[model samples]
Target: MSTVIAYVDGFNLYYGMRAKYGHRYYWLDLAALVRRVRPQDSLVGVRYFTAPVRGEPAAAANQSVYLDALAAHSPAEVETVLGRFAAKRLRCKTCRGPLTCACTPPVSHRTYEEKATDVAIGARLVEDSALRASDVALIVSADTDLVPAIEAAQRLDPARAIYMALPPGHMRPSRHFSTVGYFNINESALRACQLPALVKDAVSGAVYARPAKWH
Candidate 1:
């Protein structure tokens, strides 16, 4: 059996799912989803890279619960690696001022970028590929920034398979890079692989309820 290790871009998957299906399938089971998508391969692990939601208490609470649920999930070995959000000031091209200055169009506004996640994923992927930790590396994301890492991994292990996997509902493929292959997870998998409404933490035995808003 070919060993497969999945690297998931949590935000990318989240926004895409929200845009396409709303919160109906937010309580997802990462392992089962992977199994549904790659039934023939032996999955070894799943690395989930994400950041704590900021400026939204309800959203952050829900995300925390979901992360805990993933931690307690017995069927899959999932590791949650948190990155961070960095603020960057936006300025109008013409006025070079804040949005208040009022440009004709395309007003500037403060925005935050997710930091460290891509780098962490890239470094880990390259290391794992170089070490031959698994026979296949499954990267799930639409970000083109990952192109260089994927290419480097391929160069490191020419015989190993490196697949660029798009999460369910992602129609457009990243035009930046080529890999050994590309895979698209379907909506059925996302719908069918939801976690239980009440998940008990495997370590603390604390029960977490699904967010009311999610229902």
Candidate 2:
């Protein structure tokens, strides 16, 4: 059996799901979802890369709960790797005005961008390939930035199978790299792989519940 490690780009997947399917699918079971997508392989591990919400208290709360639930249920098979959020100033396209614009904005607005998520996913993909951690790497992302990493992994081991599981609503493949085959995340799969409303850790008796808003 081929051993598989799944690298999930959390922000990319989140936005894709939100754009097409909304928040109902947010309470996902990471390991179960990977297994559902790649049933032929032996799922060895899942690495979820994301950045914590900066100012949005509700988002942060929901994310915290979800992460805890994943850990509580699949501590051995799943890992959450966090990135940081950076605030950048928005500029006008026509005049290149810095935040302060006469047309729409009196001042520049701050938009938070997720940092290091793609890099983390890419690095892990290459690292896993180099270390022979798995026979295949299943990437759950649509970001083109990860193409370099996939290319590098192929260079390290041409025999290794690299597959892309595009998030919901994403149709285009990576411009720099190509996989053996790519699959789309469908609503049926997401619905079937959802975590229960609550999960509890037997060792510590800690309970993690899904946020009602996410449903």
Candidate 3:
């Protein structure tokens, strides 16, 4: 059986799921999801890339709980890679106009951009390919920014297969993801692969309950 390493784009998957199904699929089992996506392969591990929410305490807390649950799940090996959020302040174009202008003044607001995620994924993908970590690299994301990295990995070793799986109800995913194969992920699989309502840390023995917002 081919060995597979599943790379998950945490925000991409989360936003896609939220857009389509609210929080119905938020409580997920990474291992079970990977197995459902590729039942024929041996899942070596799952790398989930995401950044913590900076401003919303409730949302941040929810994210923490979910990550903890994933950590507690022993059936599937998962590694969490945290990125960062870049907050920038800028004035609106309209507000930058001349003082004599009758139009409303430009408003300055802070915007948060998710940083280092795609770059990290790309780098990790190439590094793993070069190291021959697995026969197949399964990236569960529709981000086209990864195209270049995917290309580099394939060039490193043409025999290394790169598989892509899009989130359920995802629309307009990149068509260039079929280098070697595609993994099927749907709402049914997500619904069936949910983690238990309460999970205990495999090592720490602390119990984590599913966030009520997620339920």
Candidate 4:
């Protein structure tokens, strides 16, 4: 039996699903989804990378519920790794332009940028390969930064197969990811692999319900 581990990029996967299919698939079962995607292999583990919402309280609550549900249901198969965001200031493009205008006023806004997710995924990918934890690494993302990690994993263990599973609606992957074989996630599979409306933690007896907005 071939051992397989899946690396999930939470932000990429969330945006892709919402953009392509809307919020219907937000309650996805990661292990079930991976099983549908790769039925031939034995799924050993799944690593999910994401960061908390900064300003949106409702969205943050929904995210917490979903993550808790995943943990409550598939505690043994899935692991959630959190990243952080850094706030940065951005100036208006009109303020700094080639053409000088009298009405060009200074405008700036603070925005948060996701940090450490790609690095975390890369580190896990390479580490797993080095440890021979799985015969195959199924990376679910379109991020270009992970290419070097995939390449390094292949170099570290020539026998381990690393494959890229692009999120929905992402047709073009970076040139760096071309060397690795790819697969496009289908909406039908996602539709079939959804978490239940309610889940309870066996140990703590804490219940997690699906968010109403996701309905």
Best candidate per TM-score, number?
2
RMSD in Å for model 4: 3.4
Q: Is candidate 3 or candidate 4 better by TM-score?
A: 4
Question: Residue by residue across 100-185, what tens digits does model 2's lDDT show?
Answer: 65655365677888888988898899888899999989989888888888889999988899988999988867655545568888
Decreasing TM-score order of the candidates = 2, 4, 1, 3
Off by over 4 Å in 2: 100-108
Judged by lDDT, which candidate is best? 4
Better of 1 and 4 by lDDT: 4
Worst 10 residues of 1 by lDDT: 99-108
Check candidate 1 and list the clashing pairs: none
Decreasing lDDT order of the candidates = 4, 2, 3, 1
TM-score of each model, paired residue for residue: 0.90, 0.93, 0.89, 0.92
lDDT (Cα, tens digit) per residue for candidate 1, span 1-215 = 89889899998898888888788888988887877778889989999999998767889899998898888875357888899988777877999877654567655567688898888899999999899999988888888888888889989998888887786676757667655578777787887988898988777888877788775
Total clashes, candidate 1? 0
Q: Model 3: per-residue lDDT, tens digit, 119-146?
A: 9999999999999999989988888899
TM-score, cand. 3 vs. native: 0.89
Deviation (Å) of 115 in candidate 1? 1.1
Question: In candidate 3, which residue ranges exceed 4 Å CA deviation?
Answer: 93-108, 178-180
In candidate 3, residue 67 scores what lDDT? 90
Q: Looking at candidate 1, what is the lDDT of residue 112?
A: 80
